[model samples]
Target: MRIKYSIPIVFFVALVIIEKENNIISRVSDKLALKQTPQTLVQPSRPASARPKANVSVTSQGKRSSDFMLMKRRLEDYSDYRPAAAAAAAVTSRRKDILLLATTRTGSSFVGEFFNQQGNNMFYLFEPLWHVEKMLTLDTGGTNATAAAKAYRDVLQKLFLCDFSLLESFIDPLPVDHVTASLFRRGSSSSLCGEAVCSPFVKGVFERYHCGNRRCGPLNLTLASETCREKEHRAIKSVRVRQLETLRPLAEDPRLDLKFIQLVRDPRAVLASRMVAFAAKYKNWKQWAADGDVHVDDDEVKKLRSNCNNIRMSAEMGLRQPAWLRGRYMLVRYEDVARFPMRKASQMYKFTGVPFTPQVKAWILKSTQASKEAGGIYSTQKNSTEQVEKWRFKLPFKIVQVVQKVCGPTLKLFGYKFVTSEEMLTDKSISLIEDIL
Candidate 1:
């Protein structure tokens, strides 16, 4: 009986030892697998209570004395390292350039400002390609247009590469327009200025523009500073490039990580806004035309027509793009952004890998105020839904008819229904137009 009991005890002891050894091997394998994973994804989860509390009791010497407290502090020290490493990784890996591609009167300026006002991390250039457009004086088709398109791509490449020195060779002081000049002036404020205002960078723009006085110097200085090297994100808003294909090379370039946000607005709304702005800017349209050719295309009507067609073409290009190509190009509508500012802004920030900081949120709220207070067609200060449907009232029935005829299909493609003449004759139409005007 004693021998039988001894044999069973020995067998049980051996089984226990083997089980413990197996557990040890399993633990070792798990540790090895954990080590192989990228540090960014290796954050270990713990209970909330496990975190070190500052309010916990301390010893006479000010050190945490309790075992739980001591363990908590140690865990926190280890935990703290992860976020720092993660932030550094994010900083090194985030996108470098964002291009807001749109045609005229699509609220590109507003979108540009939205990107720019995010914080110091973001540097924005409003229509850097407008400089190129001014230089070429070319139309948007044929071999000349192709050459011009190449030049535009080249100039943008230089900007993305952060080499403003090249602007000295080709670009000059852009004529001080009220809209852009005001934006440049805002650069004087602490919230908007970038490194270009300081030494080394400022010299490049001054030399490029041959800026003799402060007349338009600040504007050029801001532009030069905003595009300088070493920023988390850099952006430029362009109305000059009518088609997305023109920017395909820049988007595909390996040397630069580029993102394109195709900002669009309802064609009818854009037309009405463009006409209103043109009328406001040039009080005497006939005299303005007689004085000089205002645009490559002559009359305001012609300009509006060309602009609507450009919007249509841009939409077609975006709609037909392949899935892989779509990753580089994101389409944003002015109506959606204006109607749902916070949500749309968040989407934009998320898409660009930009953090939605408190400062950016505050600026978005403050900037969306209507032009009524500031008194300009270019003012995007208003954050109201009113702007989204303003074209319904402001655009004349004939102009609406023309836009609906040309852009109806594209509008439907984007989910906007075409309005019929019978609908325009409704009492709601006349009253809505009168109330806003």
Candidate 2:
């Protein structure tokens, strides 16, 4: 009877000790699981075939403790493990889409070269929307502004994604099934003219192919698409995107990390430059300047007012920085860039989160310090400092007053001081540009 009772009590005590040990192990496992990294916790379970088979059996408390420690070590290792390929892919797959948005004759082309000269990693487009504006304005008689804006946004969105199919529809003498040499300002984009798109050149050469030289054949859109895809970044310089607010949908796109640099210039300077660059179109403006009679109510004057209003409104929207435009919209004055090209370029590059490459720096140095202005009206190369005040001498007093009166709000908003006289307009002694902008 003593032996039977003793055996039963010993059995009960052994079972209690085992239960306490199991509870402690379970608690430790729970704490270890809680400490695991989010990636480890969320990672899908390994297949039964892939999982390691347990070879050691727990037969003693000491052995179980050893197993618990092994489990802890494995869990810690799993938490820290990230495949090198995945890490590399995450870094390389990051894409930046930049839009250098501005009106024509606002030094957009010059600023665009900042991105354009970013070497092979960048796929830059120069006024691809010129085709869209040309085709759409003709089709809609320039009255369907809303429709045109939507179309511009759509084409830009697609182009950012490397889809040239939508843009092809707007190309005049429509692409013969996605092939065209007639892409407007094709030579302006170095990527389009470089290898893969235009080839049979010396391998490893960095010099861009000039379309004017006709060294390459017609642009193959398919090749261009592939080249665009291969690139890590895409930049488009456009004067056609009139309103900053119109691009909200693009800023919110899931696939793109898009940024806008809205380049603006003094309206007086812009008008003066337009008068010279677009002589045929601005004949009436030239006459008005000569005659000292700018009909304030004339269609041209009203159009100027409207353009200024649009620019001012867009700028106001960007400055207000609604949720959509936050961290995405940047306002840059053409005057600032002209006065300090390198500094301004650095800021712009930093804003876009791209490296201000040595190549771009060299280009800016060469382009801005040229002895004389090179190329046509669309040329980016010039003595930048001299270029800033060229319009002061060119625009007459009457025209200045006209712009000041019509675009008063715009002038004030952008910190452009209104000149009281021709002397003030031409005076380099008195700085027309305020630092406020």
User: Using TM-score as the measure, which candidate wins?
Assistant: 2
- What is the TM-score of each predicted model, taking all chains together? 0.62, 0.76
lDDT accuracy of residue 208 in candidate 2: 30
User: Could you give candidate 2's per-residue lDDT for residues 1-437 as a string of tens digits?
Assistant: 99989999999999999999999999999987776432231112235355222232344334324433432342233222234224434665688899998998999999999998999899999999888888877553564678888999999999999999999988877877676757877788888888688845444533332465446666789899999999999999999876777788999998888888888899999999999889998999999988888788888898897798778667666654456766676777899899989988887776666777999999999999887747667778888999888898888898898888877766666667779987888888988776632
Candidate 1 C-alpha lDDT tens digits along 343-427: 7787676656567788878887877764556536766576466676676766555556556654543454444555667475333
RMSD of each: 19.1, 19.4
Query: How many Å off is the CA of 298 in candidate 1?
Result: 11
Clashing pairs in 1: 196-225, 367-381, 368-381, 368-382, 368-383, 369-381, 369-382, 370-382
lDDT (Cα atoms) of all candidates against the true structure: 0.57, 0.78
Which parts of model 2 are misplaced by more than 4 Å?
Answer: 1-93, 139-143, 199-214
Q: Which ten residues in a row have the lowest lDDT in candidate 1?
A: 428-437
Worst 10 residues of 2 by lDDT: 37-46
